[model samples]
Target: MITEEYLMQKLSRTMSEKLLRHARGVADTAEKLAKKYGTDPFKARIAGLLHDIARDFDDNEMLQRAKKYNLTVSEYGFAMPLLLHGPVAAVMAREDYGINDQEILNAIALHTVGSEYMSQLDKIIFVADKIEPNRKHAGVEGIRRQANVNLEAALLSCFDESIRYVLKMGFLLHPTSVKARNSLLVDQGSFRK
Candidate 1:
């Protein structure tokens, strides 16, 4: 397990502070969700902390890192710059940061453009990222409320919102996001509201 101090040291000063605070917020949210759903708090915290490790990087740098780490960048990622960060972050988290845990890496990789086989930690980070305290959106408060009530329901809401937002912006939806929604729908019986 990488120490928090070591993780902070690896980040740039500005990114370190911002990511640390965000990580803490995600951790808090993750812990709450984990407790509610009977998942592991420690795993949730690690997933939350590392989810955005590549968020601060620019498009060119992100692609470079992705290539360096031999991450299989999807066509969607190539067309849409925003989607590249998560998978790139996963690779960097493993190769650069020496975090070899597959579950943690998968959580980071799929947090943005989620996948079909998302683990519990993946769901925790995905929902936590959307509902973290600093996030302000039209229905974020409602989503957070739903998260408190039911984690699966919260994820359904979040995934629906994410897809709608992406389509509204005239961007191509990553297939992984669709797969995630389908998987969740199978688990939760479709998104509501």
Candidate 2:
């Protein structure tokens, strides 16, 4: 198990204070979600602590760092390198922090753009990143409440919110997020919203 002290030591050396605070918030939120949803809270907390390890990197740096890893950048990722932070951080989490759990790595990598087939831990980390206490947005509180009731529903709301944000910014909406949202709706057998 990765101790909080160990994570803080590693993070403090590479992350900004603001980023550390966000990571702490995500860790706490992920643990709570994992406990609520009957998953491994330890994995959730560990993934959360390391999820944004490369978030402070600039756009070019994000791309550069990703190349050093085993990951391939998607078309959307090339267009928006900001999305590469998760994948880059995943590599860092594995290499620098010596984390070997695929579940935690996937959670870190998928937290930014989400995935079509998200594990329970993946959903926990993803939703926790959005609803963590340090986060502030329009419908975040509603999403937080929704997360406690239904993880998938909260994930759907998050997808909806992300899509809305992309549209608002006139950015390309990544198909992965769209597919993820559609998958949730399809499973639910409705798409009224």
Candidate 3:
């Protein structure tokens, strides 16, 4: 099994100190949520730690990595280049880092633009990335508080914020994001809203 130390070493060498610390914070938050939600802590840790692995790479590097992994680059991913990092990192984690777990890869892949069939670990990593202690935003506190009570609800809140932000910024919305929101809304019986 790949150890946390190994992952940390790789992360430290590739990312700036600030980004590395953020990754660690996300890992810690993911572990806490995993314990609370009865999810696997190991998977949560890996997902959180590697969620932003592609951030340090430039656009060409990101695209190369994505192509190397056969990830389809969508119009939304192109417009919002940061969105490609998640899926690219997922591929790098598996192909380069030798991470063979599908759940972990999926969690990393969908952290940015979540999908309808996200697993518990996926939801945990996604929420942890958005609401880690170091994060500051207008409504972050509310999402953080909701995470403790209802993971799904917290995801809904986070996705809603993301959607609003994208719309306000005039960024193209990813279809996966919309599907993710719809999936959560359906689960909450608020799909019509």
Candidate 4:
């Protein structure tokens, strides 16, 4: 089992100072959310810390790692190589960090683009990544407020923001994100507010 300190050291070596701070912020937020939602705080913290492990890779490096790991890359993912980092990070977490927990791996993998049916841990990590203390997006406060009342509602709000941000940036929307949002809307039985 890899210790949290060891993971932090690994992250320090791989990420820039700003990114390391962001990872710490995510980890703290994820740990708190895990406690609030009655999940394992340790797992949430670890997953949050490692979620962006491969984020610093350049386009070619991301594509190379994705191919090396045999990940199924979507067209948007190819265009936006950053999207490939999540799955690549997951594989790295397992192989290099010796993190064998599927829930933790899934949280790391699905944090950027949520899954169809998000587990509680997945929701925690995703929300924490968005609403961490360092994040200052326009809708962040609203989602943080919703996070206190309902996990799913906050997740939906976060996803909505993500979709809009992608659209505004002229980036192709990843189908995984759309499907995750659709699943949440269906599960909640509601449309865009």
- Stretch of 10 with least lDDT, candidate 4: 184-193
Better of 1 and 2 by lDDT: 2
- lDDT: worst 10-residue window of model 3: 74-83
Question: In candidate 4, which residue pairs clash?
Answer: none
Q: How high is each candidate's TM-score?
A: 0.89, 0.96, 0.95, 0.96
Which residue runs does candidate 2 get wrong by more than 4 Å? none
Off by over 4 Å in 4: none
* Error in Å for residue 18 of model 1: 3.8
Clashes of 2: 0
lDDT of 4 at 69: 93
**Model 4 over residues 21-138: C-alpha lDDT tens digits?**
9999999999999999999999999999999899999999999999999999888788899988889999999998889999999999999888897899999999999999999999
Task: Give the range of the ten consecutive residues with the poorest summed lDDT in model 2.
Answer: 62-71
lDDT digits (tens) for residues 11-114 of candidate 3: 88888998988999999999999999999998899889998989888877877777778888887766667789998988889877879999999999989989
Top-down lDDT ranking: 4, 2, 3, 1
Q: Which candidate model has the greater lDDT, 2 or 4?
A: 4
Report the Cα lDDT for candidate 2. Answer: 0.91
Cα displacement (Å) at residue 188, model 4: 1.1
Clash pairs detected, candidate 3: none
